[model samples]
Target chain A: MSDHAVSRRAFLRAGGAVLTGTLASTSGVLALIAPSTSWALELEALDAHQGATVLQFTRHVFPHDRLDDAVYALVVKDLDAGAAEDPTTRRMLIDAVRRLDEASGGEWLSRSAAEQFVQVQAMEATPFFVKVHSTAVVSLYDNDMAFAHFGYPGRKGDPGYIHRGFNDLHWLPDPPDGASGPVPETA
Target chain B: MDMYDNRTTFAADDDGVVVVIGSGAGGGTLANELAQKGVDVVLLEAGGLHTTDEFIADEWPSFSQLAWTDTRTTMGDWRVARDFPNLPAWICKAVGGTTVHWAGASLRIEPHEFRARSTYGDLAGATLRDWPLSADDLASYYDTAEKKLNVTRTNGLPGLPANNNFKVMHAGATRLGYETCHTGRMAINSVNKDGRNHCMQRGFCFQGCRYAAKWSTLYTEIPAALQTGRVELRTRVHVARIDHDDNDRVTGVVYFDADGRERRQAARVAAVAGNSIETPRLLLNSESSRFPNGLANGSDQVGRNYMRHTTGTVWGVFDKPVEMYKGTTMAGIVQDEARHDPKRGFVGGYEMETISLGLPFMAAFFNPGGWGRGFTEAMEQYRHMAGMWLVGEDMPQADNRVTLSSEARDAFGLPVANVHYTDHANDVAMREHAYTRGAAIYEAAGATRTYRTPPYPSTHNLGTCRMSERAADGVCNGHGQSHELANLFISDGSQFTTSAAENPTLTIVTLAIRQADYIAERMRARAI
Candidate 1:
């Protein structure tokens, strides 16, 4: 298939295979496991539960109805790698998960989506929340799966859209040809 | 048959060479113009070279790669200070300077803007001044700059085709009884001209146009200057200080090379074009016993009167998919509001130009520190949103200045610039008027909901080192020569007397072309 014809499902399926490949490259440093059928994670420093909470937190920060959980897991991958590189990041992630559980009556994962959102909102001003949100805001949305889900045409225009659908916005009324006024004799 | 020369080097002790710092619209054009006249020059640029082929397509990665990521601190009541405290300006650090990141909206300053102090009279707390020269003095040079840059809608070049974003802006502008709206006078090519490729609607103007369609000095004037074999272009050379002789005439520059070794290059003249912030910081850092206050800073106006245009963004969410990011980043403009009508509850004027940010930048700048359902829902309409940037003339204030930071230091161990700014009352009123009018344009175009975002980091960045008729009033004369030091010149937007309601690249190049002619004439007359 042409590169443009690759659908969102195909993109996510390719992402899963890439994750399996990453598990081998990070053999000593990382451990891979499938907690659910929809998505799998290979985490370095963050544990399974810590990685899952970060994924959930990223979803609340940028909740797209059409994006898959695997797309949101990209944020977890980045956060996990950062945590592995720095002990401060690891401590912040661990402390943030603790605060969430305490806020949600010591059973944050067991609570409803509404209850989890309230806990996330209460910690919006925290440094950990700011760090995760800032990282995820760029990480999650910049990947191919999120771009496909959001209908953002990726940066594929080399020769560009001059001969393609550049002027194909037929929804709005056609403006007058002479709407561009006279060219002033500047030179 | 040689169209270019990529290799040219100058000796460090070459005293006869004219040294021009920072290769943007000003210094790049000035260097080339002098080289074309057979004058030897050495152009020193702080950033490394990245040609069109090295340009990136992605937003976040490209911004990280191209943006001036040096240390800077901002303090003010302006929202940008709270939103982006460390990054006060969004200029490029690459060899072409901010010209690589510019939107190609080339416009000449309106005639009335040249005499702002006389036109607007005394505003209560503003210290505005008239330019030493008039519009007539720069008209022929503007004509030369427009042709050299191949600005569309002039010199018989056709304007770029209107995109969906422009159509949205046009529909709203027409419905509001406003005239003078169209695809703008862009420096981007509409057809193949001057051996460069035409724009292909690539939709990534800010990431450095890979096709060389947009006019950046990196691909144009710098190479042309080298082709003459009269210029030596050195990248990764950061100038630390401008050294002067006993007579207080600038004689050479002290700089650190790529290896971080201290070196000095002797020069017959020194022209500074490191944008507004760094230009003033360089002058202030070069304090000596002879000129203890700073070189050419006898009037204490070197770091004063900074101006970034009053700017904001208004995004409109429509029911249908607009696909706003399909064409050029900024292709459309509305000029009806760009007039000095005091009845609009403010002095000066503003221009509304169609702008698009990629999904990554949109999320980061949409609300800055916003989250929750309201933020996500607005972002959900990414494919259905149309956006426009409102840029009005901001007042030049003495206190809105760039000073050397007391605590922060750069890699070279120099104090970084601390940019302090607050909106003048007139600036506040102008932004409010522009924001309301900008939102109304989108609303008239059938937007279901509209989002008004505060200004991001400044892209305009002007008027720190200003020009005036009298030596006591400003730093430079009409010719951009320093009043106290004849051989020193301010060759960038930093010399702007007033921040006119126009994009500055065209005017910056025009002034450089004029400054080149003046410098060449002075050399011939045996005058420094």
Candidate 2:
């Protein structure tokens, strides 16, 4: 497939899955888990239960309507490796997950979205929360896959952005006469 | 086009050549100017030469590729130290230095700004001094530098087209009855000239302009100097210290090559331009029995009065999708507030320039440790954000300086430079005023919400080994030649006597062009 075509397909899938996930929890969980299963199974740092908690935690930190489990999984993979190397990071992640469950009365995953959000909020300023939030912010948003979801056409190179949407602003009124004009093509 | 003489071999005893350390705006421009005057120069740059083809357009990746990222320590009450401890200055560790990563805002120092001491008067807790050289002394040189860099809005080149972020800024400025809003006078080209392409508006000005539209010394001065056949650019040669003779005259530079092997390049005259941090550190490290306090540091002011511009960003969320990241990173500016008005609770002034950060950087810097719903909402409204950066004159404080950290050691086992900064009362007041005015402008343009961000890692590092008329006041003289050592010169912003309310690159290049003329004249006269 062409590069644009592949990006379009990913865009469509990301839109459908994330929108469905937002509307209903059961369907949302299924939609999130389907494409992310292979990556989830490859977790080296966290066990299945801990990985699931981390996945949920990342979504809360960034929490976009269009973001999918795959974007969050990028954060999970990095965190997993970090935890594997550092004993402090490993202990923080495991303990944070346990605390969330205890706070939610063992309904951390099945609880209402509002309740789970509150549990995450209570863990704010904690080392575990800060670690997860900081890592996920970069890993989740810094990916090309996530860029597609947000409608960010990453990096226009080669035949640059000049003749493209760079100057196209339909929302803005036309600039005052002589303030700006179309760039003359150079020979 | 033999535009490179990558000298792999230079004898240690070659003292006839002039050695310039740090090939950025200052050193690069100076090297080219001196070479054109038939002077042989050995330009030693600590970083690798990454050409335009190696530049990526992404934020994080480009930062990794371009940022200094050396093992430096930060010990200041400033937010940058707390948020970004390791990366103190956002300069480049490449051939062109920070010019490779700058946003191409080229501005001249205002007439009054050259004499901050006379204009602002003696303020408490500030070390303000009038530049020994005035704006008039540098005006002709600024013109020359502008022509060399192809700075737009001059020499008949048109200003850049206004992008969405600029449009938003214009709309707001017009609504607020502020008149001086326009696409800025940038060094980035509006038309192809001097064997370089016009800007393609790739919106990655900070990530190394691949189009070569934005003038960087890496592509412009460095190549031009080499083509003269009088310049040799030695990249990845980190200068450790400036060596001087018993007479306290600079004789050579001791450096580490790409293989971590110690090498010495003898020089008749040595010019240091390794930014503010490293420049002072080098002088301090080069202490000898003759000048124990550091060479040419008789004033004991080698690393004093460090100043980064008082900077912050305010992002305005509008009802419409501004799509701020579609054009040049910072093309538009509102200069209405740049006038010095002490009645507004600040001693100095600031410029409100339209700025845009990519999604990844915006998330990291919007609030350093920010998370939760508010942060998420800002990220979700990324498409609807219009941002403006406030670049203003910050006070020069003796206590806020770059000092050699006794604890931290760099890769070469040398004491790493520790930057310590505290926002002066003047700086704090100026920032508050700028924030208020910035938010008001966006609000006038119908912004639904606005968020203020603290200062990020500074790209504009200035004033550590500043120029002074008196030897006891600063390190260098008006001509950038060291006060105590005639053959030693400072060719970077480190020689700035006072931080002005303008971007420092143009002034740095202007000073370098002027310094080269003086160096050539002095060589003929045998003044040293």
Candidate 3:
């Protein structure tokens, strides 16, 4: 997608390395070094299709927040595992996305990347879906040093959170600037 | 988020004579009080501050940085995260806590709200009843809290420039013969108080007030408490458990440091102010062989009786512009219907209020119904868009509780708060009634378009660790102390006995001040 920064493969590589502690500060939101083997297995599980689906889904659910590699690593790990531990939450998120795609007359997983990105947030009212989207949404747009870890918002060294500092980078999308999608009908 | 790095252990080398957990209304005011009383205090906050600068212009960014938590992921039941299937509820995790984005309307609990059981004792699937304390007990405190927060009544302000939405709401209430008054007791500075400026009528309270008009802990109590130098605020330390000795005495707290380092601090006593979900989770996580059922959990009631403000909303479009978002967070409240209306078949009551909504999210979400151009048209008539809420009462159900998840953990290896709440029958009825009433009000006000948002989980979570005289009957006591552990206390909305039809910041502050006084007395006796 024109808006995306790194390719899915590059993200996978960087995230995988960071998860395994081989790399450090990938995107610099969170310096969380997830277990190495766990991340390796996660990358293998997503392959390419899953990654693409996530990007598209994220575009709609969190057009405002950033979805860099770190967030991908975190969220992907949860999805690959099917959210068994958090069944209710898992079902809610899945259903929300499913509903969003259905509202668009297409399947989120199967639609064109651009198409999926537009309607992924249609079902945001679903509780579990809201939580999932919130995780990525805040990470995407919130600018701060400590927020880099898991792409959270708020500045680091705030003396308030677990992480101290981050890149203080902002990942907002350019405004309509004239080249944009059609405005929807009023509900 | 982890146990080892928990900041709840506010005992540093400078362990103040007192320590307050959380920097929200309750903790902030209590800390200030203790400091004023010449007691050293440490105010420990789980969330950090969002500077006035970071409060730029977008709703989402402001919400993430200054609102609650960035991560939507919650702690699961036990050490597992069973992210609830389809129930999304929001709770802030910053220094200001939920106050940062709160719609600052404060209301005193009705006398009847104190004893729901006495008035509404027959509700099914609940321990619905009156509060152990009374409104009268909190009356003086409410007045004191109001003054400290610089609350202003909104009955009659200058040309508020009523949009179609306001007219609709006013006409509807008049037609219904309800005692609909302008929302009152806002924490906004109608005039300068101390050094903070007044409300600029920006309709952006939840986005982190830029001019410091709203009464968030950051702008109010926390700053005052910090002024004493007797108070030290340590943010980002995520506490996991309350460390105790063999006799069941709490020594201090254990938490993971911000750098992910595990650490422990010693204290004479501990207070659980981490809100409904986190407070009980902390009590449960502080398990030891001596306190097997969990710290102060010998009664097994540490995490029970969760309640959310029974809430519903009515959105409508008026022919004229109602700059709803151009004032204080909440301008007024309707308390006539705020009692346990059993004839209506519900366990709780409802509070009605006028709220703000900018064009972006509110207009888009409640744009009369569908997607695309339809949504756009709704925006074109932004002035016509208006929203009102019926904050109903939710009964407490054991099944609806907050517990630690077993299967999942946050980045830090700690259990998450697993909340299990389903709307009760009464709650359902109340929501329906509120929607109907809201619709009628909009119609009376001549709204061209109208709609209702029903029974969603509100951010104002309360009543997880209810207070009772007996440990067997409740998690904490009248003073908000653990039933089993005399030295342990609670200082947040978690100790709410009943969900009143009002914002809880004031109630929580009053209760916390009472607890602080009790703590001071006990400290003098060395019982702490």
Q: Model 1: per-residue lDDT, tens digit, B1-528?
A: 444345567788888889999999999999999999988999999999888878888898899878998989998898888878899999999889999999999989999999999888899878889999999999999999999999988998888887888889889888898888888999998888898888888888999999898999989999999988899888899999999989978889999999999989999989999999999999999999977877889999988999999999999999988888887888689999999999888889999999998888888899988877888898889989999999989999989999999999999999999999999999989998898998898889899989998998999999988998998888999999999999999999999998999999999999999999999999888798
State each model's CA lDDT, in order: 0.86, 0.85, 0.60
lDDT of 1 at B507: 97
User: Largest lDDT belongs to which candidate?
Assistant: 1
Q: Which portions of model 2 show Cα errors greater than 4 Å?
A: A1-41, A102-107, A110-119, B5-9
For each candidate, what is chain B's TM-score? 0.99, 0.98, 0.89
lDDT of each residue in B12-46, candidate 3, tens digit only: 53333454667776676777777776667656678
* TM-scores, all models, native as reference: 0.93, 0.93, 0.71
* Candidate 2 residue lDDT tens string, A31-69: 443443333335555666787788897888778766667
* lDDT, model 1: 0.86
For model 1 the local lDDT of residue B354 reads 93
Q: B104-139, model 2: which lDDT tens digit per residue?
A: 899999999988999999989999999999989998
- Identify the runs in model 3 with alpha carbons over 4 angstroms from their true place: A1-187, B1-17, B70-87, B154-168, B363-381, B455-457
For candidate 3 chain B, the 10 contiguous residues with the lowest summed lDDT are B155-164
Q: Write the per-residue lDDT of candidate 1 for residues A80-146, one digit (tens) a residue.
A: 7677666688799988988888887776877899989988888888989998888887887797666
